[model samples]
Target: MLPINFYGKPTIGGVIGFLFLFTAFMRKKTYTKKTKGLFIKQRPEKKCFKCQGFGIIRCDLCSGKGFVFYERKYQRSDPCPKCFQKRYDMCPFCQGNGERSFLGKTGSNKYNKKIFRIFE
Candidate 1:
């Protein structure tokens, strides 16, 4: 039998305190109440300067035809060499989404607005 103050065995009050602390630490830290989906944590997506938020653009190589014609003295039509017959490829800059995210604000005050994950 040990004394009441035995450090090896935790008291009821100590256990409660520990549980409270653990729960507090497990919570997510945010500036406001979170209603975001459990799987997706969406962020601010700005319009891609190149695609202009259209999610697509005319194929520069094939002129949006998805294929090309060999124009050397009227050669036969063939798949576009650039897009590999797909006519449109994912934009390298915005990955075909035509939108991007701004993590930090720029010189303009309007950019200071934050986009939370709840809008979607």
Candidate 2:
């Protein structure tokens, strides 16, 4: 007994009743537990006062842990065939762990004359 058209539209049942009321008002709201602060606090590990924490030292000429088998005697010819002496090889100039920055030689020529008077 369905014969409605125009004003009383039945155009395919009004597009399936507006797609079932737009899929029941498109739902998706439901979530809780709002209190974010992750919890992160960790920073404390800096101890290297000239290899005090044993980072590396003692090698002041094979003292740390290298090699140093000594015995010398150059009487005349070919006796000095690199016997074995080695001294402060790595620590020549903070190359080891002296921490550098001795700033000698008049403090780097007074810091290059104050950077050439601040670039002239």
Highest lDDT among the candidates is held by which one? 1
**Which digits, one per residue and each the tens of the lDDT, describe model 2 over residues 1-120?**
334366865678667776766776775433232457553322114333454322234545445334544556633322222223332233232333334334311234666577668989
Measured by TM-score, the strongest candidate is 1
The alpha-carbon RMSD values of the candidates against the true structure, listed in the order shown, are 12.5, 24.2
Backbone clashes, each candidate: 1, 2
- Residue-by-residue lDDT tens digits, candidate 1, 1-120: 312345577777767777778889997652234466444333225776666665556778889897786767667887888888767766555656556645332333433443343343
- Quote each prediction's TM-score: 0.40, 0.18
- Under the 3 Å rule for N, CA and C atoms, how many clashes does model 2 have? 2
Q: lDDT for every model?
A: 0.61, 0.43
